[model samples]
Target: MARDYDSQLLESVAVRRRRMRDALLFGAQRARRSTDERLGKVFAGIAIAAVLCAGCVGWSFLQATLAQQKQQQQQQYGTPSAQPSSASSASTSR
Candidate 1:
């Protein structure tokens, strides 16, 4: 029995062409489905979470500082609000 060399060669060449076409169609968009890609995504999510947490903490600290300053200002100028100054009363009488 004689093997058909031409048919085998044509089959192999067709397989190669099919693979090349498939690669061209699908391989360019997602070349490597790597574990590192997943790991990098997780690390990026963690980094974003850390940044958001830091921002919240900084915002709370800023609000606390502003409240403290407001309290200090209120203490400094509160006496005039509680009771009218005598000099203003005297000037009003005149």
Candidate 2:
């Protein structure tokens, strides 16, 4: 008789615990506070504009550096077109 009462008590406790878990799992599953969707779009637009501005600045710097190097090389070796006759003679000899 004591063993039967103990078994019944354990089964009832187990059933109550299961019901509490099920209720918590499937209840009040929505967000408590919501945010503006436009905030995300504004951030995205700013990110894209920053990337474009960086690209433009980088391209201009590259062009200026290349131009400076070309000018230095021209000063060191002189212009190739400065002596047309030598170029023609070299080509003809080859």
* TM-score for each of the candidates: 0.53, 0.46
lDDT of 1 by residue, 1-94 (tens): 1368888888999999988986876675544644557788999999999999999999999999999999999997997665567768877999
Please give the lDDT score at residue 64 for candidate 1. 100
Residue pairs of candidate 1 with colliding backbone atoms: none
- Candidate 2 lDDT tens digits, 1-94: 9999999999999999987775675445323212333567788999999999999999999999999999999886786666777889989999
List candidate 1 stretches off by more than 4 Å.
1-33, 80-94
Worst ten-residue run, lDDT, model 2? 28-37
Backbone-clash count (model 2): 0
Name the candidate that leads on lDDT: 1
How far off is residue 37 in model 2, in Å?
2.1
lDDT by candidate, in order shown:
0.84, 0.80
